[model samples]
Target: MPTLEPSAPPSTQAAEKASRALTIERLQEQAALARSIADRLPWQLAHFDLDLRCRFGNQAFCDGLRIDPSALEGRPFQDCFPQDALPALLPRFMQALGGEKQLRLTEQSTPGGAHTFTETSFTPDVHDGVVRGVFVETKEVAGRARVDDLAQNKRRFDLMADALQDSCIYFLDPVGRITEWSESAHRLHGFSREQVGNMHLADMAAPRVGEEAEIGIDDTIRLAIDRGQWETRGWLKRAGAEAFWGQTLITALRGDNGELEGLSCITRDMTAMKDLDRVMNDLNAELDRRVTQRVRQHTVPNKDLDIFTHSITHDLRGPVRHINTFAGLIAEELGENASEEIRHFRDAMKRASQRLNAMIENLLTYSRIGRIDLHPERLAMTNVLEGVVSRLRQAAPDRQIQWEIQPDLPMVVADAAMVNDLFTRLLDNAMKFTRKVEPAEIQIGCRTESDGTCLFFIVDNGAGFDVAKASNLFLMFQRQHHSLDFEGYGAGLALCQRIVQRHNGRIWLDSTPGHGCAVYFTLPVETAMAASGLAALGC
Candidate 1:
């Protein structure tokens, strides 16, 4: 290169120029970074010179205290906070400027008219090996950090229990009294929260005597407290309903010092299993009786009864169905060639076959109700009634019937499927009896008693029967109205009566010979018990 003229010995001056250029570039980057951080960071930031004057304050630093950043810029530090605050804060700032690399400080002050707390950090800004200023970062920690740890833990526990089905989770005080109740608890125990006051575990547990542990409520609590846990399965009754087997777990919730704080009671309803067990035992007993009778050359009474029922239902069905089939075929074949008397005889045969088949079906259904298990539940009567009305309307779409069903009916505890059947039968009967009346009127509703029992009624403005015949209303194969007028198998009311009795409920009728008839039934409430109103049924 013009020979690089004699490359001057790495010029010291050039090195100084390079260093200054690099420093200026680094400063520009630092300023850009500071601007980027001010907008991006959650914390508030500010800077003050050695003269203890605020030179720069980010928007957040001013906004938190409701102070304008523009007004506070270049103002003394005292202007940013209370005068009293400055005295305690000055020492931290002085320490940072006097060569401390970093300082942490906490102070309480009234910010925006509320008592608030702030944690601030001061970092000494050094230049040329000397502290030039302090860079401050401020953050407000809201109001003494008031936290409810107890409530938080309780919420966590409830969240864990919310996922369970067929299980009731509740809490009991150390003394065995109910404290907290969950929705599952209400559904399982048939008790609302308001009705659970001061109720102990013993109140719901069916008394057990001469069994393992020979344990009562006191024993249950003692075991849980002493052993820190207890689990058992037994019959439990609630709200005046029959006893149902349940598997219960009692855990003593202990404190840090191993002292009992309270107890957690988690009960899973095993009523279905218990019912199944009954069914199994019944089947076993029947099988054993049959086997024993076969060995001893004797016939079991139940077996003979079953054979008779089978003969009536199944064997007789063959001939009746054939008779109906042949009658229908004969009617089709005879056409116009048949005499009027012949046609009339064929029609009667068809009618009789249908009537017999209906009676058989009704008898089977009635028997099934006795054999099947009863599973009681809390029911929305409105929904049940609505479903019944829907089905009845489907069956008889042409009927001119007006239904005056009341709203907001009280919920009842009974087998839901049985309730549906009972409503369908009763409502259909009401519509059938009112066929002759112009604009048939049927009213279905419930009246709550002062004692909390519910009296449900189905009233119909129709061809009412004599109250004397009401006694036969729930008897098998008994009918008040002539079959020629109102076609029925005379099994609906009887089936309904059986269902009511199985539910520990009662059914009765109110009627005169002329105007209308009202059918009333009583069901126990789920949440609380009333005096058993057997007297009201006037049975």
Candidate 2:
């Protein structure tokens, strides 16, 4: 009856007290969990009270500070640091304790003679919304920073080696086992990293090394170690079982103390260079041989021509002088009775001699053209054509011809006389073939192409040719048309093609059975100019 009167229920009081206890327990659990996490973290963690006194620390913090937890507890943080250093760090600690959640800072320490840089974070520790202490986590960055610097230096060196183009760079151990190989080394030696490592230099030299040459490798290594470098050129064996001449420069790698540690071998493939040198030597020898052969072949022929020229001048002159003297005596002795038949016979003999002399002159000119070296020069096509046309008009006064010349024709490089002869021969053929036409029409022009090539063309409304027989056009003395129809020895187009080839150009024909023929030829401008200069001076 007394409890039921008006007193507060016991259950309500109990529930209020239980709620308060639960809140306290939760807070304790949270604090315990926070402390446990702070202790287990890899970074050094320490807690200082509001007064900047050390209250708690993890094992990592004790190890980092080089102090025991029992020795550090309740001690002022300033007391633990060096006397001069404490003042500089005190402000940051105070700020952290004054409810600032994070305070990041850097400090220097000289545990050894070397100074170390430490990065640390100071965090405020709070309980029930009250600033309790500062939790400090520290890490040593000096060792990691040094490792990063070394890694960066290695990357730079690797990049430099990869960028090189010429020489192969690689490292070998003291026993001549491959250690490092670059891309250039792989390209030069034909051995990749997987195939090069653990392989001895002797194995790589197997193809080039005779049984007696094996000692040279050891000698080379010893010499490099003693002299700091060794260089040699010899044949080298490749991974693909191919062998090439190589020039190898091996440099000894040394430690800081200058003791030999490894070898840096740079091998260059000298096969192409050596082969080029051999080719040059062979070419020189061949040139000498050809000179000797030419002397042997032409000596007798040149002497024979000289003898023939002398005989024709001296021996033939004696007979002609005797005949003339006898004829003069007959005319003087029997002046009135000198027979007309005798005079006519003497005239015939003179004409025959003149014809023989003309034939000999033509033969000599043709022979000289063959033996003379080609001297090319830059020549205006219009000038050469005009000269040829002037000469042709004088030679044939009765022929009526229509000559069409292209304006501003491209310049050509060639021997002027040869080009003049070429045009003359073509003009003669045109005149001969177009005899059936009332008026002969000849056209000369040039076309410039996009590829910087110039095509010179000579077209004639004359006797056309069969397409199947065009191949015979450029052959010496191989005339598709009869001599009566073309009045040629068939040497003009042959000479033209040869000249074009010498200038690194080409010649071709465009013709049909009934269509007029067009002869097209090309000349490289730069090469033509150089050759023309030589040709003009007859050098």
Candidate 3:
């Protein structure tokens, strides 16, 4: 009977009571875990009720104010913050209470009067889509360490800039306002750093006194930002209304995030060099006039002209070599301490020297081409082409090239070395100009002309120049495109022309801009001397 009564279904109220006790135990455990985590965090954390009374404070938050966590709770916002800071922080807290999150970087003074920077965030505590209170978290940013590092970097930059005698370096804000003027800059421009501070970069431009119109500093800054760098040679204003010819280089400075932060400008006083250049140009023009007159009068023989060419190149080589050597020495002396601007100047010197040296070497080669005697021999055009193409292919293994070479090309009597050089130069030119083309197409073929000459043509889909400029295509130092667009000293085509002429062949080119170029040259099937000699031998 007792067992039957006990089975009277366990009371629903008793089952509910057990479940409620378990839930309360779990909630208390979760609350304790959350509080422990908040205390362990490095950031200061706190919560404020809608009435701006502190409801909760983590260990870090209480430690900052030198108060116990429980003691800090129930305190008003005004009591937690300095009276002066309340004006700035109270509105931000109100914003968060209204469900708007707030973030700010602030510099605050400690009780010891030391200033520190902090990044703080205020988040709205929401429940069922309603704002309940504001939760605040803050972290110190080590402002003192960052300030020291910046000072060190600035000192290093100043030391490097002051070492350059002929160049002045300055820095500009993103908007081209002068921010830091170096000692060298002050000395060169005769303007004190204080005078130049916050001045627009354009203010340094000379008053356009009898000079041609040039790009404004505003345009220069824009171009520098767009292109990473911009350089120009113009007159720059100095103190006392004087101006000096200056070579200016503007390099856009970017942050780690690839954002334009500012610009570094290097201006070299080139007034002396500019005057020297003008005098040299006048002397060169006079020398050319005299040389032309002497040639027309037969006073300067061909052999003498060759000697003069060699002598001039030999004389110029010494100074170019000295420039390179001194620049290298300076770079070695500076070693790792060489700043970016100094390295830039040194590299510029090296590049200019190298280019001039290359021009001289090519000139020597061109002179030798006209003097060398051709040894004519029979050559299979197909075999010559294969060897040339193979070498070119190896040099540019990554290029995707489509070759449309004609099979069984005709044999001709020509100098083996000269023919090889001709193909190498023409093909190399084709590859260079077509560098941007995909699956670059190059065709090589030969056909018998009506005049009984072997007419060979090489074609490529490449960047071609205006046909009108073709007349000077074979002249030394004449180029249809700027060196910046295409790397060349304008010597390759001139050498190719000389090589063809010495072999008694004619070369010409046909081209249109953006289309392509086709080069044509004629060669005799057999040399007249070789044919006559064979006949006399009764072959």
Candidate 4:
């Protein structure tokens, strides 16, 4: 091959040389820029290649170790820093290069025998599934104990902030400027931390035109500074979103020096509550305007409906009584001549009529309970329960029943007639269910709660039902037991529930199959005499 010189003119050679110099200059500029950026960082950071040699060291890293950055560069870490930390430090760097993406550790080193704790982050410089080197970001944990406390507190604080989904909490500088923000604040205002910095408190509110609407953030800040706290409720504009009703509270915070440092703001977004109130107001207005008129128009028909039901049932009873009377007369006249089948047919008709009458009576009672207005008065329930037990005893005179009534029961705020009726239905249930149990046991008692309400219970050792089906227990015609096993129309419990609800009370039950059942109910008590009396009765 012939020796070939650059086949370009002198000018061309100079231009090529000039291009190379410019490229090199640009690279130097980039390196300087990078160093400048690294030097401005607060934490000590450095990067190393696969050879464990320093690619770069920031100003903070060099200054912290009292080593020249230039001397540290392009030198193996072990040769650059010949100290005991070499053994502990190299392994962490190796771990990063060996495919461990992030290795965070707090290490203590005694270089020249001075204890220093460093929180080091060994992040692998990953490129396309390959770990090329390690980027080390080390922060000096100035006081390890204090840092620990801060970290723990920060975790707890984050949890609390997350839990407050509707409340936005933030910190404002002493001069009424926003300094810090929480996640809730970001969610509520749609403003990032960077976007809200150094913003005056007054700028947060939107302009409003109304005598009642005062959106002045300055006045709010002034009040907080003077009174150490302030609260206000008003419609607040959300960033990039619709306005919402907000309840905001601001309180002053003091530094360790006992000087005013910052203001803590807690703003609760009450959009749901506001919407509910608006809806309720609209509903009430509609009810007052339109519903009242409807009620007036329906008044005549409603009263006619009540009279129709009462009169029609009464008229039906007259026909039923005639049919029974005629059937009895036929049975007497044909006593010797009547066949067994005719007699059986007549008895069946009688039974059907009786059942129809019972259903009509029960329906009338249920309807009347809803239609009639209640007149509540304070009355001793023990007397009522005693009266109910006496009636139950008369109903089943042959059955030996044991009654355990707790003495000196509390007086309840209820309609006496309605309560007596309620107890009659319940005691009837207890006796009906305990028909099989010899010498059936029933316990009537009361319990006094921390609140003023008194809980009364009627426990019986009887055929109990599955508690899972308790939801249907108070529904009309919803019976848990079979009609064959127990004789009932299934309206007693439903009526009892209605009476309790009319008195603004609650009722529940506890029962297990083949064991026993207990019916519990609550009613408001008027005085200590009633509550204390119930409590004294082992309630």
Model 2 per-residue lDDT tens digits across residues 401-422: 9999888776766767777776
lDDT of 4 by residue, 381-485 (tens): 888887888877887899898899999998776677888998898888898899999879999999887777889899999999999966788887788988889
Tens digits of per-residue lDDT for model 3 on 378-488?
Answer: 888999999999999999999899988999888777778988998999999999999887878999999988776788999999988898866888999888888888888
How many angstroms is residue 65 displaced in model 2 relative to the true structure, after the best TM-score fit?
A: 14
Query: Lowest lDDT 10-mer window, candidate 4?
Result: 530-539
Error of 3 at 517 (Å): 0.3
For candidate 3, the lDDT comes to 0.82
For 1-539, candidate 1 gives per-residue lDDT tens digits of 36556655578779988999999999999977886778576778888998889887777877765877668768888777666455445655766787664333343435564444456777899999988999988776543443233334545766777767878898776668776677778877788877875578888767556432246677888999999999877777667577667889999998677656568899988889878988999999999989777855543554456456756787778888999999989989999999999999998898889989988888777767765666666788999898889888999989978889999988777777888888888888898889999979999999887776788999999999998756777898898988889888788899999888766678999887668889998777775442243222211
Q: What is the TM-score of each candidate against the true structure?
A: 0.42, 0.41, 0.42, 0.42
Q: How well does model 1 score by local distance difference test?
A: 0.77
Per-residue lDDT, model 3, residue 371, is: 57
- Candidate 2 Cα outliers beyond 4 Å, as residue runs: 1-350, 367-375, 394-398, 406-408, 425-429, 432-436, 445-529, 532-539
Go through the candidates in order and give the C-alpha RMSD of each one to the true structure. 21.6, 20.2, 29.6, 23.8
| Model 2 local distance difference test score | 0.70
